[model samples]
Target: MFKNIKNDLPASIVVFFVALPLCLGIALASGAPLFSGVIAGIVGGVVVGGLSGSKLGVSGPAAGLAAIVLTAIATLGSYENFLVAVVLGGIIQIIFGFLKAGVIGYYFPSSVIKGMLTGIGIIIILKQIPNFFGYDEESAWDLEFFEIDGGNTFSELIKMFSNINPGAALIGFLSLAIILFWDIVLSKKAKIFKVIQGPFIAVVAGIIFFTLTLGNETLSIASKHMVSVPIPEDLSSFVGQFSFPNFSVIFQHEVWIVAFTIALVASLETLLSVEACDKLDPDKNVTPTNRELLAQGTGNIISGLIGGLPITQVIVRSSANVQSGGKTKLSTILHGLLLLISVILIPTLLNKIPLAVLASILLVVGYKLAKPALFKQMYKLGWKQFVPFIVTVVGIVFTDLLSGIGLGLLVGIVVILLKSYQNSHFLHIEDNSNGKHKIKMTLAEEVTFFNKGAILKELDNLPSDSYLQIDLIKTRYLDNDIIEILEDFLYKAKERNIDIKLISKRGTVENPESFINFFKEKPKSNISLS
Candidate 1:
């Protein structure tokens, strides 16, 4: 891991800047103390990164869990009680890892996964708009359709337009310009440009801009748009802020349910991030999902025990890590350490950094994830890909992270089922020497009830007076409902004067109504012969 320290250091700096606001935002979303998000970030980067199987994946408080965490906190009655659930959730994740349930990541369609990434990218961009204009009435962490302050993302935008902080707007525009210039212009100039990463440069510039703005009391920018870190008088006082979990809630059924919910959602998000990170890795190294779960579980357990929010393999931060050219796990670890050191050693300095500057960094990251080219590429892949991708993007924009992805996944599954029903089986036809056309109806090898509609449609469309040869020779399994389907088709065939031949392990039969009868005489097993 130390081998890539030169590259990783620069990358870590970029991830640090990107992670700062997100940590605070997610904490705000979870209804936890803002410091809890930072605590999770520290644990995610230091503990989880140290134990991670993934070389490039970064872990942190995820937006995906924002809704669940919010609901869990509200229902649990106390934040301390919620911490109990978080720790238990971590334990549950550890069990999941041991059970080797990580394979769930492999089952998602690639198209839908891409849609998820793009959808998140759009959300990041949308969420940052208010911050960019210095509208601190809401934090970047707000992901709901309507915020606690009321109105949706669009309403916030309108509000931002009516009341723009000139200082913040100026800093935001300058920060964005500097980032864009470095990313598009200077980065191409030389290897030194690459060595000094764009995000790092953007942040330094933002700090300098903030410092310049500081001396001017007439400046409209309030300190709210700046990075806010909890400033304690001393180390002992800072440590006093940490809260412990109320283990008394451990016996509550609702607490367990919340724990289970967190475990399930956190584990799923980690699995998805693992899949996505593997795709993003330049070397294409696949992360061991079970080990990733273990790493995350350990991180969450540590985080909760120490008064941190739950952690997951966060795609936004990980993608930012990768885009910033992070080459190993060291980058992720170092960034966590940076968060720890900065908050402790120089929180006042951190507070001086403008929120617009952070927004600029995220704006760049978001643009990279949801580039216009991505939209065109998905469109070119056809509606099968485009519809789900757009739906996910819109859903995430309108609703929240998980809901949009769920909508996209639902649409994607329907597409798959529709395709399956449309092409239930592969059919071949030929004419025999007797001048009878032999229609060889071969059921799919693993026919399920889902295929019944298609099979019935095809059978119903068969021409009358045809010689039908039903072949289940290679079929290993068939649902009983399909057998009843065959029985009904047989009655219709008898009326059409069609000749029928059924072939299976039971051997060939010219016409067997006894075998193809109603559900009463149907075979007990799902797979039947003849």
Candidate 2:
């Protein structure tokens, strides 16, 4: 994990900058103590990063789970009670790891996953627009379509234009320009520019901008518009920020229900983020899903025990890490350590950093995920892939992360079924000297019941006094329903004066009486994974 520390170190600084505001914002959105979010960030980084097989994925208190945490905290009657659920949730996640439930992540289609990444990217850009314009009414970490105060994503976006601050906007624009310059021009010009990433410089520039224009009414960034971190006055007060879970609620049914809910949601979000992170990894490294579950479970347990919200592999920070050239888990761990060290030693300095600066960094991350080139590429792949991808993106933009992915998965399944219905077999007609149609039908590799409609329709439309050839030479698994259909077709063929020929590994028959019997006798090659 430390092998690429030279690159990872700088990447960690970028991730640290990105993760800071997010930790506070997500906790505020979740209705948890602000310090709890920082605790989760630390746990996610140091604990999960150390244990996870994913080098690029950064675990933290996720915005996706903020709503759940908010509702759970209230329903359970107390934050302490919520802590009990989080601990139990971690245990359930560990059990999931042992059960190898991580394979569930693979079931999501590639198009859907890509759509998820794009959707998140779009959401990040949308949510941060307000912050970018210096409209800081809502916590930037809120991910739901509807805000806690009843406004929707677009509504807030509209609200931002009226509240734009010149100072913050200036800082944001300059930060973005600096990042672009460093990324597109300077980084290519020298090795030093590569070592010191643009996002870090952008953040430093934002701080300087905030410090330089403190008293200017037209240009000064407001304190409310800056990064907010809990500043402990002394060592004792810092230690007092930590809270322990109440074990008294361990036996309560409500606690158990909340625990299960958290476990399920956290596990799902983690799996999806890790999958997305793997796709973004330049090395194409495959994160071990089960091991990731184990790591996250352990991190969540530690976080929960110490008054932190539930933890998951967060795509935002993870992508920031990847975009900033993070090569290993060292970046993730270092980012977490930076959070800890900064909160303890430089809280006042950290507070001076503008939210607009962080928003600009995320804007870059969001743009990368939902690049126009990707849309063009998906469109060129055709509707089968594009439909699900678009649906997922729309769902996420209009709804939330998991909801959008669910809609996309449903669409993906429908697309699969539609393709299956159309792709059952290939038919070719050859003119015969007998003035009759000689049709050759080659069955697909895997013929399931879904193909019954297409297969039956073709068989029923066969011309009278024609010759029909059914070939299964390359077919690996022929469904019993299809076999029965073929058997029934044999009886109909005789009445229509249609001569039937069956071809397979089982040998050719001039007029096969029973396809059921032919497939009942199978070869080792003829197998169905289903």
Candidate 3:
């Protein structure tokens, strides 16, 4: 993890810059104290990063949990009561880790995973447009297509045209241009440019821009459009920000329910993010999913106890880490430490950063994730892969994260079933020089009941008085339903005056007495002749 200080250290700074405003934004959206989000961000980066097996994944307060946190706070009667649920949720997640529930992450199809990445990438770009244009009414982490304020994702874009702040846009454009130049030309020419990442420079430029144009009416960036960190007065005031869980509410049924819900949702999100991060990794590092759950659970427990929102592995921070050249868990941990130190020592300086600068950084991240080349590559992979991929992308664009994934998964399953139903047996006709109409049918390997309809229809279409050969040489495990169908075709062969021959690994049978008696110990039941 420490091998690449040159890469990991710079990446950590970029990730910290990205994670900061997100923590504040998600906390605001969740209706929790602003510091709670920072708390989660700190614990996620330091504790989870220290414990996690992922090379690049960064954990933090998630936007997906905002609605849940909001409702749970109200339902549980108070924020303190919700803290009990969060703690309980952490315990439940640890139990889930022990139970090896992380394997569920592997069940997602590749197309769906790709779709999720693309969908999230598009969502990031769409959500940041408001911030880039200085529409402070919207937060950075609101990922849902439908807005709580009656407008939706597209509606906000429409509204942004009328609300663009000239100063923020100008700064944002320059920041983006600087980042692109650093990434495209400067980094390759000099090693220093790589160590001092483009995002960091962009953010510095934004801050400097804000400082220089402060007195001008047309060019001054509004305070509302800047990063909003909670500024504590002194040591005592800083200590006053941390909130403890209300252990008194631990016995309440509602608290337990909320805890279970949080545990389940957080675990799922962590598992998925870990998988997605593994896919995004330049080194192609594979994370131990079970270990990731345990780490996340521990982080959540600590975060909940210390007045933070529930934590999960988040794609945004993880993607930022990867795009910024992070190579190991050190970047993840360092980002958390940076958050903690900055909050305590230089929060006022941190708040001076313009949100548009951060938006430009995310815009770059989004473009890489959803590049047009990926779409072309997926399309070339065929409809089976492309349909689910596109569906997931579209779903996330119009709906929330989970809903989009669910829809894509459902569609992927259907595509699998359809392919199975359509492919049963291949037909090859030998040259009938003797005019005997010799036809050969080769059954596919592991013929299941799903292939019954196609096989049956093929058998029914055979012409009268033809010589037929059934080839099971490639079949490994034929289902009982398919076996029965083949058996019934025997009687039909006699009625049509067709000569039937069955070929298998055992031997060839001419006018086989019964398929039931042929190979007493067959696949799906007895020994394989393989």
Q: lDDT by residue for model 1 over 1-530, one digit each (tens)?
A: 68888789989999998888889878887788989999999999999999999999999998778878888889999889999999999999999999999999998777767877887787778779889888853547766666766777777777778878777888788888887888789889887887788767767877887777776865546877888889989979899878899999899999999989999989988988888788878889899999999999999899999899889998889999899888999999999999999989999888888888888888888888889998999899988888888888888778876787788889989998887786667667786547666788887777778899999887888777789888888777788777778877777888987888877775777755544542244454585543
TM-score of each: 0.93, 0.95, 0.95
**Which ranges in model 1 have alpha carbons more than 4 Å from their true place?**
215-220, 427-438, 503-508, 513-524, 528-530
lDDT of 2 by residue, 79-137 (tens): 98899999999999999999999999999999999999999999999899899989953
Clashing pairs in 1: none
What do the candidate models score in CA lDDT, each in turn? 0.84, 0.91, 0.90
Candidate 3: regions farther than 4 A off: 431-436, 511-513, 519-530
Residue 8 CA displacement from its true place in model 3, Å: 0.9
Number of the top-ranking candidate, with lDDT as the measure: 2
Error of 3 at 429 (Å): 1.9
lDDT ranking of the models: 2, 3, 1
lDDT of 1 at 237: 83
Candidate 3 lands at a TM-score of 0.95
Model 2, residue 495: displacement in angstroms?
3.4
Task: List model 3 lDDT by residue over 195-214, tens digit each.
Answer: 99999999989889999998
Q: Which prediction has more favorable lDDT, 2 or 3?
A: 2
